[model samples]
Target chain A: MPQPSTRNRLLEHAEAVFRQKGFDGASVQDITRAADVPKGSFYNHFDSKQDLAVEIVHRYAGGTDLSPLGEGDSPVARLRAYLLGELERTEITGVEFGCLLGTFASDSATAGDRVREAVGEALASRSASLARTIEEGQATGAITARRPAGVLATFLVDALEGAILRAKTAVGPSTAAEEIDIALDALRP
Target chain B: MPQPSTRNRLLEHAEAVFRQKGFDGASVQDITRAADVPKGSFYNHFDSKQDLAVEIVHRYAGGTDLSPLGEGDSPVARLRAYLLGELERTEITGVEFGCLLGTFASDSATAGDRVREAVGEALASRSASLARTIEEGQATGAITARRPAGVLATFLVDALEGAILRAKTAVGPSTAAEEIDIALDALRP
Candidate 1:
């Protein structure tokens, strides 16, 4: 096992705390204290707490290997795989803070261009990947949607994020699953 | 128009700040200071910040009489009324703090039963009301959902909330409006 670096440790601990406290609620002191790093060392690693948050989101989303999702036999299976992975990850991490993309979307302070661009990238990438899978399913006559692949993918993402928001508030994952199930049914061949 | 009562002023200001800044971010000082109430008077009004937040969520959702939605021509119209009202209100407010129910959903501190129940009640009430609307729509052949009214309503609420989540984040009501348009099209007979 690769031993965790100081930077990695900071990122992991920060992600966990931010997931719990939110951007405004979280403080730099809390993160440093949680990570067992000297307060000054935090600045050494990242420009600001906002910078750290952006990196944390990138890591959280990328840290999950999406290969399994694409490996599923059918488009629906692939999409389900992606969503189920998200559900299990949240349950396990107890981070259940909602999707970082959606969370940022709900945030007003995220008006900074850099942060918005990063989140926009994450949203676009997820949507595009899902759209590709959906399009392939359509080619095979395995799925149908009144909206085009991109629009449907956008709706699915929107619904999933909303479900996550509800789940986060309700402190349960059941609604997220239900929402995904409905979206899947709607996209059925 | 009846002049705003002190309590109403406090609640209104608190709602705006809380939605814009969040529970931890919006301090009693900020709320009271905004409302021009004596700082000490805050304790006289609510038990604590958490207590204030609970009241805020209840007051915002409760203050609005749903009779307009309930009296719409059909279930689809009723549901649209509920959603469109939210969209318009959020747009006009320009605070874009996201929905109170949704804001809580993202905060991990809201895991407690009391807080969860408060948020859940708001959601459940909305969902039930929307289900009635869907039933009416289906009966009139204005909506063509194949699922039970309850299930379809749940989907619509979740999707609409997700759309609002995006809108709040973007600080633009257009996002929610666009998503609602798609949702409405889907429900068309």
Candidate 2:
């Protein structure tokens, strides 16, 4: 009912713009325009567009709901649920919007040091968590892949990102879920 | 031979800038600056920044040497060689530089319709070629997976793009080759 604070509004709008247009692709004016706030008020909240991007990275990574990973009894099944849940999300929002963390990963050139650092940490942390789950799966005999869990974890995450990027510009009816499924099946014993 | 033409110079430098900073991140001034040409001359060579980007997409895709795919006797090894050859390139250019086609794929928002079309066509064409090779591999029984060649091909290309993106923003020692190798092994019969 009550209006959110200006700072929160700025963050929400900035996230949308960043996800859609990437860090450098979207300008301060663009974010402010989307937020319907005066351009001058932008600097009042964030020091620079890059500053806003760093905050966004922190928030996006911190707020990610990994509860889907807890859905299934087996670790691999849970990982499948986690990944499929991601695809279902883009199914609702449209795949072209992309994930903010992934957008920043691909936009490191224009994203500057602070933003890159935040994205790097977020992606690394996510991959690390996935690796831990995969290791558990391996220990429990749910997964038979021989490669190190860390390696597989990183590969799977990268595959997800690649599928997302391809799906965004794809001319045909390619769904990221199918590509990711090919990956999940590969990990089976 | 005489010095390279101004137009050729713009194309080369524009490629460098776009590969480094992405389509929307680099301005016309940035291209001209990198090319050591006057800002006014940019319009003379191309109608606009987006126009030049489309041209770059065509040239980059058209110039990619998939011959490494012909390197080994087996189709899959050749594919590995081809993918490794791509990694060798970014190793020399710096992994942070990224592929122009992929940069455009991730930058579709600010890349405009024409650039997106060019990127989409190029990616589709590459994926199709990979699929054809994969079909050849499957016929020879080099690849064991039962997934359709088209699906497998799209999965491979998407995986490559994802590995590249992760390598760009990686904080640790994750190499694209290792991640890609994981994908290749997953194709084992």
Candidate 3:
């Protein structure tokens, strides 16, 4: 296959740096160095670090695998799979680095409104997707109707993000797995 | 009251700076500036930023009010009080700043082993304390025994941290409050 485009290379490397060092911590110089591209080339692709951050948020959110939420026979099973898939993805990406969306969200206060809004929108979209699944589960009587599906979906997202934070500082994925299990259990009718 | 100790003042300001700018994003200069002390004063109190960070984690963890977990007549009520106390604390501290332990934990991969281990220990201790309360709940028949108390405690911590992450970017505490309600609901026998 042909080599990756300059923009693709920058996005790929910049994501790792941002995930590892955070949006405020990672500078244009750092991104350029990691990408092995000159400093001048960065501006050619994105206007500012803030611009790059919004792009990264979009890229990361766009790539999230929601298929597990859609595929399983039962809503609870599908939700579990979706959450487990996230934990597995974090494991593959290196748990120590944690989630980019989480890291950015934590630092969004100082990162500017543009980046903050992008991260917010990305998370809202994820929550909406999960809400749809919960709605489906509620319709089938698989999940509890004590709370609105939208509310429960937001809770799952919050809990999953929280578990990832814990896993980042812990020994392995066991903590994350247990937390996800509890989150799914919370959804039972 | 007597003026706060210089060291205490430094820790207070440094925690806010770290929370807002992140560990990597905030430099010694920023901490000193925020603390209103000379750059030389920082060195006089601690060997390095990392040393100061370790102390901050200890202080934050120690200051966390687990009294709610100890006070109520019923185990579930006690647990609820404990968790709600935490949410209130986060609100007082400004959720926009998020949790310092969480903010540091996310960046631990590059923040060094000393900082990472200190944060990990702080969190582990907090979880242990919560687990003891959970065990108490289990023995009293106020909490389900379907899973180990230790497992449930860890999940509660994960979900709370995740909710804080969401509240940091959202408009108010409603989302965090709703999420916490669900987490507690999941614990019902």
* Backbone clash count for every predicted candidate, in the order shown: 3, 0, 0
Worst 10 residues of 3 chain A by lDDT: A166-175
lDDT of each: 0.71, 0.81, 0.84
Better of 1 and 2 by lDDT: 2
Candidate 2 local lDDT, residue A90:
62
Pairs that clash in candidate 3? none
DockQ of 2: 0.72
Candidate 1, A106: how far from true, in Å? 2.5
For candidate 2, list the clashing residue pairs, or say none.
Answer: none
**What are the per-residue Cα lDDT tens digits for candidate 2 across B1-189?**
899878999998898899899887899999999999888998888998999999998898888888876555688787888888877776677788677777788888667888887988888888787887888888878886588888888888888988888777857875678777777766766
TM of each candidate vs. truth = 0.86, 0.95, 0.95
- Misplaced by over 4 Å in model 1 are A1-3, A110-113, A171-173, B1-5, B64-68, B71-74, B108-113, B137-148, B171-175, B181-189
Please give, for every candidate in the order listed, the TM-score of chain B alone compared with the true chain B.
0.82, 0.93, 0.91
Interface RMSD of 2: 1.3
For model 2, residues A1-189, the per-residue Cα lDDT tens digits are 999877788998888888888888788999999888888899999999999999999998887678866555688777877787777666666687667777898888778878877888888888887888898889988876688888888888888888888877856886588888788766776
* Candidate 1 lDDT tens digits, B146-182: 7677666767777887876766545222356656655
Candidate with best DockQ: 3
- For residues A1-189, write the lDDT of model 3, one tens digit per residue: 999878888999989889878887788999999999989898899989999999999999999999988885788888888988877877888888888889888887788888888887888888999999999999989899989998898899889998888777764335787788788788878
| CAPRI tier for the interface of model 3 | medium
Angstrom error of the Cα, residue B130, model 1: value is 0.8
